[model samples]
Target: MALDRPTPVTFHAPMVLAVGLPPATLSRAGVVLEPSGVALRESNLLDLRSDSAKYRPLVLLVDAELYDFDPEAFDMVAQDVGAKLGVAGSAREAEVTLGQLMAALARKSAFPPPPSSADAKTDKWDFSEVVAAVAAQGGRE
Candidate 1:
């Protein structure tokens, strides 16, 4: 008589793409699974814009202390790869951040983004308009 077992599925994504992180951060994140038994890959910002990404549902982690720490650039990277941003300020923080991102990507999770301010019909001057009206009414009663 024999028993059978299952194997880890080959996820569409390569799991993790770590950028500019300290060497010790990955393991400290304490992510427990290797869904594809595949380890992470190191990357540069330029690679993110390419059409050929290594995986799907990938987690992109970047260090805040990069030589040219530009928030806009990193945001663009995340957009190009259709990924959420995880910026770590230090070695310790990177570990915690890595763990958080890894947890979010696990178990085939699908989290839709929350509504954006663009959904509102209000204009950019709306707040100032309200302020003017309040001032016209003779300050707080």
Candidate 2:
């Protein structure tokens, strides 16, 4: 019996939202700043954690020095939600970081694909065929 391979899950466009930074600055850096300052809310965290795969990768640009922010809380939430946490001391630095983050996100996967059972079943030896072809060509193998 033939086994069906499950379809891969396609996530939506990755989002980069910021807190404590002007929308204009983030826009210049190619990121859309979330208008609300509710980044630490339970509802947002829950949604982020539950629907992480449905949405694109998230990077939250936080200016803790300028705002009444909790770095530990943000880090925990980011980890739980599979999001990246970036901290900037000033608006200028935030812009620079956001730009860098955007560039990194645009790049393709940095890691290799995971091993799977399907890989084990795939044909591994092509040397015999190569040897036969070489012999037919009256060439040394």
**If scored against the real structure, what TM-score would every candidate get?**
0.51, 0.48
Alpha-carbon shift of residue 53 in model 2 (angstroms): 10
Predicted structure with the largest TM-score when compared to the true one: 1
lDDT of 1 by residue, 27-82 (tens): 54334334434356666667655522556425567777772568787777667767
Per-residue CA lDDT of model 2 for 1-141, tens digit only, reads 988999897645556545555555444444323331212211244454454434424666666563345667667656766778777666577666766665564463565668798778866669989888889889653
Q: What lDDT, from 0 to 1, does candidate 2 have?
A: 0.56
Candidate 2, residue 19: the lDDT equals 54
lDDT of each: 0.62, 0.56
